[model samples]
Target: MMVPCALHALWRTLLPVSCFINSVLAAYDEPQGRVATAMTLDPTPGKDAGPALPEAFVSYAFEFSSFPDFAGNSTSGPNLFSDQLLNNIGNITGTKPYIRAGGNTQDYAVYDPSLPVALVGVIDPERQPNYPTNVTVGPSFFESYATWPGARYVHGFNLARSNGTYGDEDLLGPVEPACRALGIDDRLLYWEVGNEVDVYNRGRFAVRPPGWDEADYVAEWLNATRRVRARMGEACPELATDERFKLWAPSYGGTDNGLDAVRPWQDGIDADGNVVEVSMHFYMSGYGLPGITLQGTLLNHTNTAARLAPHLNVSRALAAAAPGVPYALTEVNSLYNAGQPDVSNVFGAALWTLDFNLWCAANGVARVHMQQGLNFRYASWQPRDTGLAPKGTRPPYYGDVAVASAVGDLTRAEVRVRSLRMESETDAASVPSGRGEPLP
Candidate 1:
């Protein structure tokens, strides 16, 4: 049976970057489709029914890590809380809501690591499983989007020896409370340990702490999952439900994401358990946006997705090695240019987003999170100068989905695009190494 995919993961990897362009252009010779009818993309806000989504999907993401920092400013306004972010989310993806936290932020924080975690919403971290930060950020985000009809969540916990597990624990501190806050604790989809630990010190990534080993990760994860198991055992007494927890890892880039090179954390959960999901990330392009006409942008894109296939394949294979646990590309994106208005705002970026998501669903990806949709920020390629949101709309804005809604629905059709590519003789190095560090 061909099980349909929700979405495929997208991320920027050090693929055998194909610079050839003229040869890879996709043949849009099918006599324009309904979407291509407008001169430019008519992404302008058009009524409430926006467009039907391809599938009942979850808009995976890492959009809310920062809060508006306007302290004591009596601007005498609504003080843009979580609602502002959720407002746009509901207005956009009008179906099953899916979201993840921890985009380009550290898992551990300034709080004391030695003491028991003091979570705001969920009572005990052990009982709850994966809870992040406090209610201020988590609740704010949840409250904003939770009412989105049928929303679900994937929480990435903190892991690092300095605080919980230098690269262990799958660091599930703040996950529980966040789920409780969302009121979907029972359906608390999946959780990840940290962001791309494979490409350490590369892009927007921090260094692995002292004594960070693969075994250490498995051990810490064992301890944390035990708590979750204990909680599950305790649940039957109160009307029985398996709302415990699942394991996820490496949170970034499909290739290494740290699990493959490092020892697999197959400590607990037998081989047949559908409970845990070994998570990773995926992205494309070095933060800078790629340009491809309907008849262009093939070699680079295809090679980019293919290059990371090994990594994704490794991730999928982990399910076999550490059976029972499913595989997932938790964090993904076409580029790291989150807030960069130029690259992220172009129709090109929008196109990339659609293609990447479709790719994830078609490939073996279990789930995908598009960094942070709420708090869009410029990534490595954006230098220090770039706007947050685009002044006007072109692509990568809200309307990027009209196509996603279309393509995401056509899950059965094997996407076959013939592109015209002008190949660049150089390799991945041909693209300038941007500022952001590659993920660990």
Candidate 2:
């Protein structure tokens, strides 16, 4: 069956790798000895297909504590390399990529006004060396938001530290300052309350007591979000209205994890009717997993499809529950835990990224945010020099650039993407075969 997808015409010159562009249909043919197939394109939109997505459909999510390092504060000046890279994509797509300044660290963060720097973090090497396990952001932390001009953002709040008790103020403390900072330039897209709360009840990452299910999560979420809205109303009154006070919610780790991604919605997690998007996280494979290979894991189309099936199911359920609310892979990349070394950092990873993102657009997913951090093996680019890695553009950044160029100039026309069925597990394509009619 042909499904509705959204992507634009491809610019072959911008792609560093071999990607064949035939009219509006763009196909990433694998190297010789892989798979080859002929595919047809249907220009007619499917009955169930949604509208074309935004120009910046494939954006980014920076690790929370790394925001200052990636964007740089007013004092340090914006990271010129970061700006140049993002600008390259914007130049192709006609919209600067939206940034999600949140991740696991967002939940662990605490606002410390007395602190002089933008961020102060403590990384527990045993727990996770890539990101800080405990983090504090000072008043200057908000200054990083203004550094990346024309880039919109979804700022996350500290939901994990709140206990939902009558007097608990941890979750409410950052709302005022956050809203005030975002309100100044209208760069705020939506507020996210937490990150992967579903796993807070299990493993070494456990924070909530055992047996904490969907009900408890929903209640806490409602209480915290309501408080957040109330504080935002006081701090940035213009953004607190029904039209503006929206969130990207239920940012679960996966669909079949500690908590089902669909249950939170069924439990009225968005009881306030302010959840603008149903967001979730995904990792193709975990770092250090046995038998992982570039072609077998990251570059394999069949494996990618199998891994994404659950998220697609959850997206369908979310569509039924929240009608118009979009589904986004707010945090996603090839491998979790900062990625596997050789497999994730190679040129093959760029191919995987191009295939992965186009596949998402074809399957009705509204947006895909490639998650990254400093020195991360799978990161598109290292924002700063670290002990482990130097600051420079990586292979995956080229993949991001290719995807942006493929989905060109959304301001001019409404483009729809469709996947070309391949006979082999290695092949993938996003065909937009005909000239799209101009938007009214």
Candidate 3:
């Protein structure tokens, strides 16, 4: 399942990032003695084909603490490397990739006006070395949002600080500043209150008690979001309308982890009807989980389908309950815990990236945000040179560029994607077929 040496050399020359077209054509080399399977892509839309996707369908989610590093402030200037990479995709897809500045650290962040630096964080290696556990952001942190031109963002607020209690002013302290910073110039796409609240009852990062359930989560969410909306109304009254004042809700880790995905919807998580989209987080496998291999897990089309089935089901149920509300995989990547070292950073992951995104596009997921960090093994590119890694494109980034190319110019016409069924999960032809017009 490793990328052939010939293709590896081609990936190295993709500095301009537009060379994905040439590299993708030579993406696969058939193994000896393997039979080629026929895949018939019907022009007619199937029962499972999703709606026309947005122009910026493929996007990214950065670790909350690393936002300053990825998007340098006004003083240090913008990260030209990041802008170049994003703009390259925008050239093909007709829009720059949207950036979501949130992850585990988002819940841990607190605002401090006096701090000189954009952010000051303390990383506990035992919990997670990829990002900080306790994060503080100063007034300069808002400058990072202004760095990336033409890119909309979903700013995450501190939800975990409430610590299972509602109406905690400390938790609401960051809302006014964030609203004032991003509410202008249409730069804000949506506001996310938390990251993966479903797993807050257990694990090393648990913030809620053992008895906490979906109902408790719903109550807390309603209270906090209502207060957030009221604060925004006072801070930025112009953005308090139905058209703009929407939030990405629940931000669950999975369908059936500590909390069931559908239960929150049933519990009236969106009682105010301001929830514009449903957000979910996913990973193909954990970093040190057993029986995980690039070939059997990441590159296996069947495995991808299996992993996505539950999420798709949740999406379907949400559509039934709240029609027209889009569902997105706001936080997702190949492996959790900053990804596996060799398996996630290699060319095989590039192949996995294509299959994963195409499958999601065809299966009704509204958007897919591949999660990344400063030195995460599965990052599309290392934003800066650190002791652990260098500042350069990784193998998976080629897959991202190829996806943008496959999507083509969305501004010209509506795009519909359908996965062509394959006889084998390991078959190289298991890619989706996309059309520019609505399928009849």
Cα lDDT listed for each candidate: 0.39, 0.77, 0.76
Model 2, 1-440: lDDT tens per residue? 12223433332222212234221133333343643444454455454334576668879999999888999988899898898898888887788888999999998898877889998899999998888988988988998888888999999988888885324466887787788888877798999998899898998768789999999999989988888888888888999999989898899988877798778888998888899888999999899888887757765555677788888888888788878888899999999998988888987788778777766776778888999898889999999888888999999998898777666666666755655433332233232221222111
**TM-score of candidate 3 against the unseen true structure:** 0.87
Q: Candidate 1's residue-wise lDDT over 1-440, tens digit each?
A: 01112221221111110111111222222224523211121222223211222332325565334311210012222224333433344444443435565544434332233333221232234432222333223323333333333445555544433233343323433444444544443445555555455544343334554445555555554555455444434433221134444545545355544434325444433322434556666655433455522212322344445655676567556756765544556655555544344545454455455444444544545444555443343221111122443222234433234323433332332221111112221211111211111211
The TM-scores of all predictions, comma-separated, are 0.56, 0.88, 0.87
Segments in model 1 whose C-alpha atoms lie over 4 Å from true places:
1-58, 67-94, 109-147, 161-176, 184-187, 197-211, 228-244, 250-254, 257-262, 265-274, 288-299, 322-326, 337-341, 373-394, 397-403, 407-440
Q: Pick the candidate with the highest lDDT.
A: 2
Which pairs, if any, clash in model 2?
A: 5-417, 24-432
Error of 1 at 121 (Å): 19
What is candidate 1's local distance difference test score? 0.39
> Quick one: how many clashes does candidate 1 have?
69
